[model samples]
Target: MNDTTTFKQSLTINLRVIGALLMREIITRYGRHNLGFLWLFLEPMMFTLGVTAIWSYTHANHLGSTLPIAAFTLTGYSTILLWRNMPTRCVSAVIPNLGLMYHRNVVLLDIFVSRIVLEVTAVTASFSTLGILFFSSGLMKAPEDIVPVLIGWMMLAWFGASMSLFVGALGARSEVIEKIWHPISYLTFPLSGAAFMLEWLPAPARAVLIWMPTVNCCEIIRQGFFGPMVHAHYDMSYVAIFNTCLMLLGLAQVRLVAERIAPQ
Candidate 1:
């Protein structure tokens, strides 16, 4: 077979499998619970609500120049959680769901795609409800631009997925990764885009933070929702480049891990 033709066929087959896995995950995950799909939407809402309440109480007086509390907190908090959850969930996916991979068809991509699908579903339900409720009530006016925001979201998602896959693959073999995860998570908060916005951070700290690709994800996404008021500085290209590298690394790691890890 021609190499090009073979590659195309492989791609096609992969797409078919991905689509099937997404459907399967959605049905099985939500179907098992009585609340079912409601949980998907509710997870984000409750998460957002809890964060918003805590922040509003502490940062009530500090609006960060001209940014509104609701708009700033929503985008920043949601995007932060989005990136953070990817790796955490992905790491857990392998061990817990190993039984499903007994079939040859369930590859690493299946796990990655499944996690991404569920994450997207949760975010969609949450952010969609949030936007509608907030906008309808006149909480946020309108976005100045949406293109950069979208680019940021896609990059962040890719970053999260890639990083998670890499770590998950490592965890599959060593089994040591899961042990440090609690400390890793705790140490992650300061650097995470959730705790502070680009505008609010001190000049030096903000400059340092801009180097972190995850920060760009939240910053650009927040800018998309809040515009100039939130005061965000992001480099989408930076995130895109890092995400590409991470994804490749993760893909390679997954294959390696699979060779050593027999499906349970």
Candidate 2:
């Protein structure tokens, strides 16, 4: 076969491999019982709803903000799930699926991609469902601008997927990564801009926190949701540049791990 034909064939096979992996992952994780795969989105939805309820009960929006409490919590917690769950699911991902590596078509990248795709799809579904429910019930308002919300969400997915790939690859080399990551994830949750808007913080703290890509992503999403009612601080170019670098590093690390673990 010519080089072009060979490349096309490989690409087609890899796509099939990824699809199969996705199905297996869903069945294995969700099973075919009560709600089954529906739980994928429902799980995140319930968590977001619970958080919104707690915030409402405690009057978490007492910061002189005009945004609805339901909308604020939904947007904030949904973004948190997008970035947090992906990496958590991906860490030490390869070891559990190592048996599948015996199949020529199943690659390490496929495993990570399948998990990341699953998490992103689940979180996005949860966000959309809750948004619709809240709007209908008059608990939240329709977003002022959906374009930025979509852009911000896509950026967050990229950030999460890249970070998961890097973390998962490194995890194959050492178990310590998984241990260290748990605490770090918890510690960073408050600063991730999921619980508050950038405008709520003083100038000095806001300046430092804006450096986190997830924080910028939350700001972009909130800007879309609340519009001029809130001041959103973010630099899209900076986010794009950081995501690019991280993605490159992740791909390189995955390649290294694949070589190391390749069957003799």
Candidate 3:
């Protein structure tokens, strides 16, 4: 058979395996309820609203200073939530599914890619549907600049995929390392540049977080959604380089581990 035929057969086989796994994951999380998919949207919306309530209480004048409140908070919160979910989802990707490695056709990369697909499917739909509703209903306004928001989401997705794959490999190799990850994840938040706009950060602090790739992603997202008044002082070139390194390292580590962890 030609390479095309081989790839087609491979994809067809891979799709069956992946499809079954995806369905199991969805059912496991959402159950057989009518609102299964709806739950995904509700989950993020609820989290955003909870955070917004606190934000409004503490900083009553947040969006009043610039953009529309609902839109600003929804987009920002959803973007952060999307990036944050990836690592956690991936940590489970390689470990819990370790048994799948037994089959010659099933690879570790398959699991990682599957998790990424799941996150993307849920988040893209959730964000897009809610975003449109908010925009059309006059609950939120369009950004003065669209490019930044699109760039921001793409960057976040790439960074999330890269880091999660890397971190997932490390976590799979060592439980002790996984233990340490929780504290680090908690610490990353203050520096995450998630809840607040980058323009709000003071000079030196801004200098630091802006250089951090994920933070830069957040900055790009806010600039896209919020207009000229909103800004994130990130270095895009730095993030691109950082993600490249992480992707290579992650893929290498996975290859090394897959052989060792292959199920009987």
Q: Top model by lDDT, which number?
A: 2
Say which prediction, candidate 1 or candidate 2, comes out ahead on lDDT.
2
TM-score of each: 0.86, 0.96, 0.88
* lDDT of every model, 2 decimals: 0.75, 0.92, 0.76
- Best prediction by TM-score: 2
The candidate 1 region of ten consecutive residues with least summed lDDT is: 60-69
What lDDT, from 0 to 1, does candidate 2 have? Answer: 0.92
- Could you give candidate 3's per-residue lDDT for residues 1-264 as a string of tens digits? 899999999899999878767776778778888888567567776777777667656764553465666776777677767877777777756767777777777788778877777886777677777778778878777776888878878888888888788888887888776677677877787677766666776787777667678788877777777666665577788888988998999899888877678574
Look at candidate 2 and tell me the lDDT of residue 37: 97
**lDDT tens per residue, model 1, 1-264:** 899999998888878777887677667667865887677778778888787777667776453355666776677667766777767777767777777778766786687777776786677567767867777888776667878767777787788788888887877766688677657965877787865677787899988999889788888777777665666888888878888998899999989977776677
lDDT of 2 by residue, 117-182 (tens): 999999999999999999999998899999999999999999999999899899888999999988
Clashing pairs in 1: none
Error of 2 at 60 (Å): 2.1
Candidate 3 TM-score versus the reference: 0.88
